[model samples]
Target: MPQPAGFAFLERDGVVVITHHGRTATTLRGARAADFLEDVEDGDAQEIMARLTGNYRRGNERQARNHPRNKGR
Candidate 1:
């Protein structure tokens, strides 16, 4: 997947930290993540972040904006 600019995440010490545009959007600690993820139908931490911060959309935009069809329009 294409990565959004300035989007970074780190999972350390059983805690998940998400940053978008260089600012923290949310954090998931061990206890909370366990509780939350357990109920999730079929999603892992990385998928959660990708949906939350719209990283995929950004990546698509980044890629599309350079296409010839988008030029000067």
Candidate 2:
């Protein structure tokens, strides 16, 4: 079991970038609040983020699909 490395949280030009190693997470706040990762450069960051978010959303969708909070939808 290895501990994870420290992560860097950066805010630049209204874009917040969270990076650890080569992985990155990004968030934008304003009229449109969007949260995602910065992983479209010349590396495996896109693939890594795709896999990570896929799993994350899958679990969330599963929970939401059965939750009563969204019963009308």
Candidate 3:
């Protein structure tokens, strides 16, 4: 089966970005990366990526509700 292209791991300022085919698909903070990666490494790359970013998505949604533009909506 085909698979995702190699991912690039980059840190600019403090965030670590994971990209495939040169497109950023997700990010994790440098501090959380080690333990988070260790916990998810056994899964397929796509699944592992989804697990990593899934929490980010949920967190973003929760945070968006608090954003000034979204507040009281």
Candidate 4:
């Protein structure tokens, strides 16, 4: 799978942070991903942000803009 365009990270000490252009492909999904990896899904925004510290969201405009023509939105 391709990268999600953006993501977030928590330092060893637990400081939530975000990345506009992510370095890795394929975001780590699920609670662990949201909790530990710091990446939050857009749909899950309210739920995730409420529990977590901040937004580690990525790939919003990029996904909308770069969607594969063959995929058929």
Compare the candidates by TM-score and give the number of the best one.
3
Evaluation by lDDT, superior candidate among 1 and 4: 1
| Cα displacement (Å) at residue 73, model 1 | 36
Q: In candidate 2, what residue range of length 10 has the lowest lDDT sum?
A: 50-59
List the pairs of residues colliding in candidate 2.
none
lDDT of 3 at 54: 51
Residues 4-65 of candidate 1 have per-residue lDDT tens digits of 34545666777767777667867778786565455344755455565655533334786788
Which whole-number lDDT from 0 to 100 does residue 10 have in model 2? 52
In candidate 3, stretches whose alpha carbon ends up further than 4 angstroms from where it belongs are 1-15, 55-73
**How high is each candidate's TM-score?**
0.38, 0.29, 0.39, 0.22
Clashes of 2: 0
lDDT of 3: 0.63
The C-alpha lDDT values of all candidates are 0.62, 0.46, 0.63, 0.43
User: Model 2, range 1-73, lDDT digits (tens) per residue?
Assistant: 3433334445566665555554554444543222333343344544544333332222378678788988888
Runs of candidate 1 with Cα error greater than 4 angstroms are: 1-6, 31-47, 53-73
If ranked by lDDT, best first, what sequence of candidates would result? 3, 1, 2, 4
In model 3, the clashing pairs are none
How far out, in Å, is residue 5 in model 4? Answer: 3.7
TM-score between model 3 and native: 0.39
- Candidate 3 per-residue lDDT, tens place, 1-73, comes to 4654455566666666777657676878767766555654665656566556553332377778888998779
